[model samples]
Target: MDFGEYDNRKNRKVESGVPDVCKSEPCMMGIDEAGRGPVLGPMVYGTCYCPIAKSSLLKTIGFADSKTLTEEQRDNLFVKLDAEKANMGWLINILSPNYISNSMLKRNKYNLNSLSHDTAIGLISRVLELGINLTEVYVDTVGDFNSYQAKLKSIFPNIDIVVSKKADSIYPIVSAASICAKVARDKAIKNWKFIEGDLFHQFDYGSGYPGDPKTKQFLSENIDPIFGFPQFVRFGWSTASSILDTKALPVKWSSKKAIENSIKTPVISNFFGVQKQETVKEKSHKFFSERCLKSVKNLF
Candidate 1:
């Protein structure tokens, strides 16, 4: 696999096989994602493309829903795809935990669903932009299946898109994408490196899921004075929220109501109430008027 950063450093893109899909006949591709539930590591979006007719080649290699396969099985399947690079190509988008947290915490408010949609769309758009003659796209849905399908259809009106439940299990190409995503996420978790002077290691955090006792314990114990946990943890998650609220310095928030209440406003009398008028002072006599100037000239 070739590893590199996307134009934006927020995410990394990995690709395998340098097939010229444009020159060859049209092909079908699949898109799927992994690690959406984990609070640690990156959420990876994976895409696999191959000649539609050669899809049987994928089935022969035992590609299936990655969740059903053991870690070793997934690793072996990746090796198979690597060996058959000439026939199949795959790509992945690694959305780091830092990236995910920052995006979620932005003032504009980017949710996970939108992030996932954009990431998947980006990968598919990238493949097509690379001049690949992609015909059909199959994807597993994270939310409303129909809504996601509609979104893809609007983007690729010329191509066919199938968004369904468990597409990774139903479609061979999707299963291949699942393998790529799952393997990439697992590798990221396994190779996680903490920065210098950090007291905690990746193992101390377990799988980085909120339900994991180790992960919860790590978040509970590692609350920083200002920054919370290291970059490995998602500070925007509820787990971090609870810890910061309870253990770290108390965070005070100014709500709209509180601000409005704090502002002072002068009371206004009723429109029918009597009004007070200012007394008009008599016009002060001008010092040395025309008559006074004449008298002064006579004296000179």
Candidate 2:
């Protein structure tokens, strides 16, 4: 059999890339991941398997891509689907920022994408362990959909993988998987806060997405003084590495009297020039000013 030619399609299997069992029976599983790009959270994988007969129920349950749903909507649907489904499983693979940083250094690879694919494979393995017969699996594409499918297939030789650019949006089950993954990941992150108290003081850090200013600030504030970057930061990243070479100079502040005196005193442009006549003030004013200036300067 030429496995290269089999393909997964909506109602009908294509001549190429179609699984032999899918021709006789539809055994489908939807796969997705959450927290792939987050620098401070765990990467989660979700897989939901249902018989072909129940596929329509997934749509009725309001399952779509997790991205398309608001947090509240996703939370609602996640609870509903969790109670409704026959067999649903999830794997929350915690990837700390420190672990990610080390992985980048040792493997010379981007931790986000690496964790995404790893989590996807992990869900697939769990599905197999549950003894569910999986013929074709649909997954939302992260990077190179085909490459991700190939990687999954390499690990599970007989598994037929269907990877689409937005499979989660198209397939209800994939969307459900996305919701489960996201909800699980969010809960895990919240729980982590209690466990790692004060470690991540800036709560506004918004899940470490690149667009979040709080996340950037958190990273900036945590840099190692000697190494110039935090041990938990991905130093290989340009943003983290740049912090190492940059230094913030200390800012000096002067007392009010010192500032006033400095402005009043004529700055000598050339020491060799004849001394300019000094302006004299009232005896009382001069004495009080002198005493104040002396006291302020001594305080510093």
Candidate 3:
């Protein structure tokens, strides 16, 4: 409840409810983020001060990878965590899709890893304002582990940072931070849906992950008119770009030149000394066929 006194130095890092190598060190803070990949919603970063003595309590709250837990499970865990902890502080940055798009356009690149690291650093800096004698911090790596640590160090020259891949899975405090971040993001998304009204109603895009069929359907249907084919959807990302490009234009071929140019005319290839030419159809047929082939290949 008293966010003012929260300090990273009073919390120690533990691995899966057990104190291992990090036990000898003093308490530290754990940081993580959520909703980085989603085309919708804001990017949220969370940091928590977990003491070495309360590692068991964190485990009992179902602390694990946020990706592995359901929304209900995360919400439940977040509630329990809020009730048990007093040294936890959260900082959320609500970046709209439009703002993200503009940044990508201005930068001429989409750097999600860098963006995530920056957000995490912002939250960590806010936590440091309380002057909790925080010497060290742990974060789930968004880019090169060492680079992320260095970036955090540059921002907060005094704080020692450890950035590891899958740190949430390996560190109990990091996992707790993950749950907090996820729950906060999910709540923000739900609230956004309520505020956006009918726009979210037509598109019941379940979480914004690529694995979600509803999300893909929503993107396919609305990306062109509503979201527009811009940097907001991560133009560098194949999925986002593919959806935007495919949906932006109409399926119908307007002219003979368009159809002819679109056709995939295969060149002759020698297979075991035998050469053959394949006549490939144009437009949707060829595109759908190639996509299907690629999908089939990935499955095996």
Candidate with better TM-score, 1 vs 3: 1
Quote each prediction's TM-score.
0.79, 0.64, 0.64
User: Model 2, range 1-300, lDDT digits (tens) per residue?
Assistant: 011321111011111122233334546788787766655555566666666665777878778778877888889987776665343433334444545555566535555677677767876776565556677788888888888878878888897788898888898878877887777666655554322236654445655765578777876776645534332334555555555557533346898788677665565776778888989943554323321222334433
Off by over 4 Å in 2: 1-26, 85-87, 107-114, 194-199, 224-236, 245-300
Q: Which order, best to worst by lDDT?
A: 1, 2, 3
Put down candidate 1 lDDT per residue, 131-225, tens digits, no spaces: 77889999999799999999999989998999999999999899999999999988876665554234666347787788999888877877676
Model 3, residue 121: C-alpha shift (Å): 1.6
- Supply the TM-score for candidate 2: 0.64
> Which 10 consecutive residues of model 1 have the lowest summed lDDT?
290-299
Cα displacement (angstroms), candidate 3, residue 171, comes to 1.1
Candidate 3: residue 281 lDDT (0-100): 46
Comparing 1 and 2 on lDDT, the stronger one: 1
